[model samples]
Target: MDQAPGSPQGPQDAPSLPKCYRHPDRDTGISCTRCERPICTECMISASVGFQCPECVRTGSGTGHAPDANRPRTIAGGSITDDSFLVTKILIGINVAVFVMVLALGERFLAETELIGYAYSPQLSEIVGVAHGQWYRLVTAVFLHQELPHILFNMLGLWFLGRIVEPALGRSRFIAVYLLSGLGGSALAYLLAAPNQPSLGASGAIFGLMGAFAVLARRTNIDMRPVLIILAVSLVLTFTRPDISWEGHIGGLVAGALITLGLVYAPRDRRTLVQLATCAAVLLLILATVVGRTVSLT
Candidate 1:
């Protein structure tokens, strides 16, 4: 099974094999038909001529969608995917994976990731948090969950709400909304919560999905009672529950609603630009606030 580096007589030595562009660890001869990037079997997309990468098939030049009608689209002018729940599933997997990592690595990992403007960590034996320029905590904490019940509740909400929102807004916009909501939640906690008070969870992001679902339900004539009822209950709990980050939850809800409003109401002729601009503006505002808070803390 093994061969010398310069034996000049094995498949492993074949010049045809090249490392996949997306996953560089593996070698693949097959390339994307559209982008011509080296792609492994996992990343290949079957096309009329040859296999293409997922990116090329999704938003880039399509394989054989000559007719506009055949090329179905999402409400936000994105290509409709065959699996509406793929993004949601992926999000859950990521959260679970991170949770497993935290379990394996112990409190050190959790201390490093949990959102805090400035909190001294007993595990780390020093001052740790966003104010010390560990800005990635804002993002990592969104997916980090210390308790089983916390993740299960948020993932359940994500599963139901994501199924509703992702299909309506398309994968790109749905994820954009989801991430923005998470960041909005983190930013608010950083700005308003005690600097030493660390908080972490997907609640901010899930609240965002719920908010987006409500917006889409109204626009598409779906029943809004389910979302409203759940949202009301969740908010009540957020305010009453001990150790909960209320600021993050409220921020995510507001951000999700604002982003979805732009998505579902953009003019058809310029939907893409408006959507991009809207997400960008919200992201900039979030960043500006975070910067201001960081400056204040530091």
Candidate 2:
């Protein structure tokens, strides 16, 4: 059915300019300051920042026109958000749970015997050596802390820094940072350790956080001088303490920095799944190398 010549269509089919509360008769373009309803040029008034209708400006309800008001609020000191709260909780829980297990096993097992020790020592090891070797120790040692203070400080640091770092990078990337850092630390400790001496701790991963923080600061528009100071202090402590694994600390730091660089520069608009898959591939490569070296050495 065609319309008769020069006949106006019904309201449903009519070509009407959208209604403007400010100027009903005028073609709607700009929006009202107070209600965000489209308004035409005739009824629109210029505000200090944006266009506002006369009624909205008169009523002092033209905040929509203030460009600064719509801008994101900046927190003092520019600290990153505590976005990884759940990740922090899980990591801390795992550390504490493992610590409890260590305590339950008593001082002898905790101090003298480690999974690695059992595998390496000939007299004590029978089938466990064949079943388990120094290879598994690289992963297990990451969860085993020697003393209460040792676990406490590392866990606390993990919570503090992980929360800051995780949200920005997301969980999969954060896990990659943690595991790779721990592995890197273990590798360094293995290289530096005598056959008789045993090394264990999460400090390597904690140091990784410090390194990632420094790298992350470079990407964001945040001042990193304070963070640099914190890292320097940690480095000093790592060197000054004879018992500390300085090699692990340095190794983890380097690994963390490199991994963070990869994550940050990766295209954000790309599918997160692809980047995660890439990370998993890299991690598997590192794991294969670490495990192969450990098995051969043992």
Candidate 3:
């Protein structure tokens, strides 16, 4: 029975009991933590850790009140947050922003005619002339898309893949995958491209996402046949499409898959860190070799 508010003794003096969410008559005094509403004995629900009001409990809702519901989830060696969905948005924003910059600065004239010196190159010999000397392009070039359709497709792939991958891998791991894939792609291009030819696109990074997905699917209980089919189709489109870099795509795919494999098979969080370190080490070695060759050629 609920004590009248005016009772001199207060809650301490009354017989404490649970109440239903709807009932104003009988005092059943139990409350649900989730909704913070009252519930009576007949309507009260015992959750994993506590009692919940009928509405919040949803008896047949198939919701097994997980004891860890109130606790945080750490999955794939990273903090799990609802905001993981937003990582895709951020990547979209970056690609769009870079495209806008390309547009604002003017197209062919700014991209091809005006040269940025700090491009990445796989060939040490190319570094001697402005034609291929800008090694920094290896990193920056990945962001440079010459056409709208190019950026559009790349962004689409990133948005789709990132939404799925980021949540599974966490923010840091996703970021690492993107950067390393792009770099690896660029490195491969540098080594393979004709000294004077300039290459740029987010294709490498997007391919990385595909590779990561493949690894993730294989490691987890997911059926990967559909994903594999999609990947194969993407490769076909890549080659048939004019101005696309097949080499970059292949390089990024290999790098992403290898990185993903390491992360998935590793013992624990240590694997995630180890994958990151391996990528870093390989990239550094490539950079050093490229830069050294460039200096010698110059």
Q: What is the C-alpha local distance difference test score of each model?
A: 0.83, 0.64, 0.67
Instruction: List TM-score per model, in order.
Output: 0.77, 0.63, 0.66
Q: Write the per-residue lDDT of candidate 1 for residues 132-208, one digit (tens) a residue.
A: 99999999999999989988998888988887788667788989999999999999999999999999999999888
- Steric clashes per prediction: 0, 0, 20
lDDT of 1 at 38: 85
Candidate 3 segments whose C-alpha is farther than 4 A from its true place? 1-75, 107-109, 112-133, 292-298
- Model 3 lDDT, residue 44, Cα: 61
User: Per-residue lDDT for 41-94 in model 2, tens only?
Assistant: 777765322355565455444334445433221111111222435766788888
- Top lDDT hit: 1
Question: Which candidate tops TM-score?
Answer: 1
Off by over 4 Å in 1: 1-70
- How well does candidate 1 match the true structure in TM-score terms? 0.77
| Candidate 1 weakest ten by summed lDDT | 60-69
lDDT of 3 by residue, 89-205 (tens): 887887788778878876543354222333443443223323346555667777777689888889889988887778667787788788888877776666666555567888898
